[model samples]
Target: MELFQNVVKLRGFLGRNADVPPSDGITEDAYTILHLATMSGTWDIATNDWKPRIDWHRIICPGPWFCGFTRGMRRGEYLEIEGELRDFEQDRTVVVVGKRYPAKHLSYTVHATRIQQLERPLLVVDTGDDG
Candidate 1:
């Protein structure tokens, strides 16, 4: 089976290099949606074992968290997002009410639990006891 290597913390720019859009994508199950393309590098710098690319993610923000993000997140701001990374296998065989089509691609997304900007976090998870 799988062992370890599932979480990631990235510091980068948005796909638009400014404003980030709302979370949007096809749901992975009943509770997750892949959203946003987080650009990790300027593409001008290349190193061995470094792949030139942009990382698309599904930063999980359940309920009010998401609403708050779109409202507070501004343009052209560099930030850090930390979360769990997972690869999901999707069946793209059906399109438009039962049309069958085959697709080839591996999907990897991040479920961000927190974001930081200039030593300040937008949201913090408080672990508490039920007692």
Candidate 2:
């Protein structure tokens, strides 16, 4: 078995239709981008009410295979995705008043290994107990 693992599984809905940007002449650069959203609820003791939270995720699939399939997917379409979390670093140079400055930005994205569309979502039950 492996000693280290970086796996992420997310079940959520599509925020919008999938997009495939123009390839940058690199074979491995061909990929699709998907916006996914998930929800979580918690009972607030102080407010004595339930609070809902929504989390958005950026998903990247490395291939042109899923383009057609995901292109037709509409917003709020339920999906289950399995992948690993990846971090990307981007560098840029800026020029201001004849001076040059370098900048670096870091971003996190989920690299999907598998994706499936679920016809129906599991039911969520609300228990009155604050426990």
Candidate 3:
């Protein structure tokens, strides 16, 4: 299956669970910002065409809402992710495109923990190539 399809499936699964921890609760304003970011994917600096990059971290994670969540986390509360943008798919929901680091990295563990805590299906797409 495609990355976006997997994300949608995950979201559906998360929606069914009641014990999942909320990820700082998404606000209407945050949602609006996300919408805008998604729309701005048409401007390509290199190609100069309206081709959207499928990298969610670049398109969505930099928004005020995501930044707020990252900032709100206490020290050592969550793992820090650092990687390059890969791809994204906008089918019903947005799916992030990136790759996780080595198992020794705290970011990987933190991401796994966060995914478990999510009340809604939050898809973190990995390219299976960690380098």
Candidate 4:
């Protein structure tokens, strides 16, 4: 539990520095993808003492749209994606399917998942309404 907590703190710090410049030879697009995969959501956990394990519904990329890239790729293109999550701190690793330029081919199915610690309060439980 303590190790997970430390990992969460580290993730938070890294997320805060998400806008920092990237290393040499790394394109802006690559950096953006990395950032999106790692730090795309708010961190909120149900309890501070324990980090919850989360199983996210597979995120399906519609058509040519990359996860965070506004410019769509096309309708049979496949991309390699890997992800990890601890509590609510989640990160995804994506790889372009082929060496094709402009990646026009679409994928039949593409999904990505990640784990991260959330920093928001959960919604209140719903109560039955009395008419």
Candidate 5:
């Protein structure tokens, strides 16, 4: 019996191009990073309407083959991704009023095993007439 499992499936639009670094190290050749955005709506009681919220995610593509597959993908493309969540502690410096403080933050990244492109973004054409 397996008590622990980390799996996630999401469909969203690509926010930017995949980040692929030069294959200088063994680990570098095995993974690439992608930024994706997912949108969800929630009811706003004050406005009596639904409000849309966007959530951004960082995805890590494993394997050189998969990295190659994502390298050609462009922004504004819709995609479906399947992966496991990976979380780590990241240290950063925060500055406030010329004062610097060290902080530790927990960051989560998706390690993708499968990815599929759904559709490309639509293009709008303008006709110069306003009626």
Candidate 6:
């Protein structure tokens, strides 16, 4: 029987963009990003305290998304990720399959179905003052 769920969502900063192995045409398409995340889960209820912890996960964007992510991200950029968690074979384990968007310095890899940059847009304000 399935004891629990394997769904997760995370928003965190990147450690660095490291190039991994096995490129599917594009060289940068095999890159991986180490994400640093912090999350708070539902309270214990009994203890009336929430589970707040810092998590680090290794997120790899394979194929197309790999190239897409590399093009859109910078060092320490904030990203939001949502996906299904699974287990990988080697090195990077605990793979997440979905979109939106790691940390760890852990053993999880998020195969993103979608990824978006959470960068703040710079707005130019017009004060009617001609420069």
Top TM-score prediction, candidate number? 5
**What is the alpha-carbon lDDT of model 3 when measured against the actual structure?**
0.30
Tell me the TM-score of model 3: 0.19
lDDT score at residue 10, model 1, on the 0-100 scale: 76
Alpha carbon deviation, residue 1, candidate 1 (Å)? 20
**How do the predictions measure up, each by TM-score?**
0.47, 0.74, 0.19, 0.17, 0.79, 0.49
What TM-score number comes out for model 4? 0.17
Cα lDDT tens digits for candidate 6, 58-122 = 66565655564566455577777765665554432345676321322324566665556687436
Where's the lowest-lDDT run of ten residues in candidate 4? Answer: 7-16
Higher-TM-score candidate among 1 and 6? Answer: 6
Question: Whole-model lDDT, candidate 5?
Answer: 0.87
Q: Each candidate's lDDT (Cα)? A: 0.55, 0.85, 0.30, 0.30, 0.87, 0.59
- The model with the greater TM-score, 4 or 6, is 6
Candidate 1: pairs in clash: 18-76
Ranking by lDDT: 5, 2, 6, 1, 4, 3
Clash-forming residue pairs, model 2: none
**Collision count for each candidate, in order:** 1, 0, 3, 22, 0, 12
**Residue-wise lDDT of candidate 5 within 1-131, one digit each (tens)?**
78998889999998998887665642644788899999998998998987999999999998877767887778888999999999999899999999999999999999998999986667586776887
In terms of lDDT, model 4 sits at: 0.30
Q: Report the Cα lDDT for candidate 6.
A: 0.59
lDDT of 4 at 122: 48
- For candidate 5, the per-residue lDDT at 34 reads 91
